[model samples]
Target: MNREMLIKLWQAHKNDEWPHVETGQEGPLMTLDTVISGCVVYVLDGEEDLDEQRRAIVSDCLAELDTLEIEINDECRSYFGRLREIGTLLLITT
Candidate 1:
């Protein structure tokens, strides 16, 4: 995904403003799954290329989530899987 779009999505998720899900539950404010899925949508909608910096940001965000001990819900896991499939297709075609 374009680094700028990815960063923007990441920032949105970090701020708990992702449009897909409403905020206000308990526990961690954000999760890796949500951030990654948001990034995927941003990437796909923008038709942006996934470069090293974008990948690094994704990796770092995921790592940070892991360190935070946040658990991925089933819905988020499903979203991640779908994003992975779509991302794979985009990679193969581009």
Candidate 2:
């Protein structure tokens, strides 16, 4: 994930502008999940390939995601599961 995108996501999260589930579109949530998943892949593939600064941004983004208050409805279960898995992998590998 690029720094600009992370910053945008962070800003959107801070503004409570994401998680568009109420609109019947889980796009923003999906985007966040994808970005985090990508981070995990990159971290596993080669942590050295990612810029140190970008790694910090990713870490901060994941931390921010950790603070999110998502409802555990059926629609969100898979996403949350993957998020938790990603978080665990990050904790173990990073």
Candidate 3:
């Protein structure tokens, strides 16, 4: 919900990016695809039994990702579609 929580998650992902770096890369080498996908899954599954705070946090993450200029590839597009379907179902049921 807060900036601190979002920063924590981002930092975790940032740390996780190190091992995936290519041999000759200079900066962080992780794909936006992988990072965003992990974030999406974390928001969805991690917030499955959400409290108000968790829902707000997940919503904030989703909003932040929504604002970014991410180039979704075919695989990421498919995951997004699936996430939309799941989100729709949750909305309808709740």
Candidate 4:
């Protein structure tokens, strides 16, 4: 991610602020819990398989989570781990 994206990501994820939603199934959509996971979802964007560029972006976003220093609860930890698994394939195949 570039500096601008990093800035936006930090802004969105800062203070553990949740996304504002008037109506949605928050219970089932754990991806929205953090900006990084949300970026994973956006990169996937309903794709059935991961492409190289998409994979890198997702991987970078997941790795970027570490620098954020936010507490990862059980739910987000599981979600992020799953995303990492999906992107890790890029390391071998790319």
Model 4 residue 43 lDDT? Answer: 42
| Candidate 4 lDDT score relative to the true structure | 0.44
Summarize candidate 4's per-residue lDDT along 48-70 as a digit string, tens digits.
34466656665665565453325
TM-score of 3: 0.35
Tens digits of per-residue lDDT for model 3 on 1-94? 3333444444444454333223433131124334344544565456544445544544554454354315444434444443333333332322
- Model 2 per-residue lDDT tens digits across residues 3-79: 33434443343344333354433554565566766765565456434556656655665665565535436655545
Candidate 2 has its poorest 10 consecutive residues by lDDT at 11-20
Question: Candidate 2: what lDDT?
Answer: 0.52
**Best-fitting candidate, measured by lDDT?**
2
**Where is the poorest 10-residue window by lDDT in model 3?**
21-30
State each model's CA lDDT, in order.
Answer: 0.48, 0.52, 0.40, 0.44
Task: Give all TM-scores, in the order shown.
Answer: 0.37, 0.48, 0.35, 0.35
In angstroms, the error of model 1 at 56 is 0.6
Ordered from best to worst TM-score, the candidate numbers read 2, 1, 3, 4
Candidate 1: the clashing residue pairs are 1-50
Ranking by lDDT, best first? 2, 1, 4, 3
Best by TM-score: 2
Q: Higher-TM-score candidate among 1 and 4?
A: 1
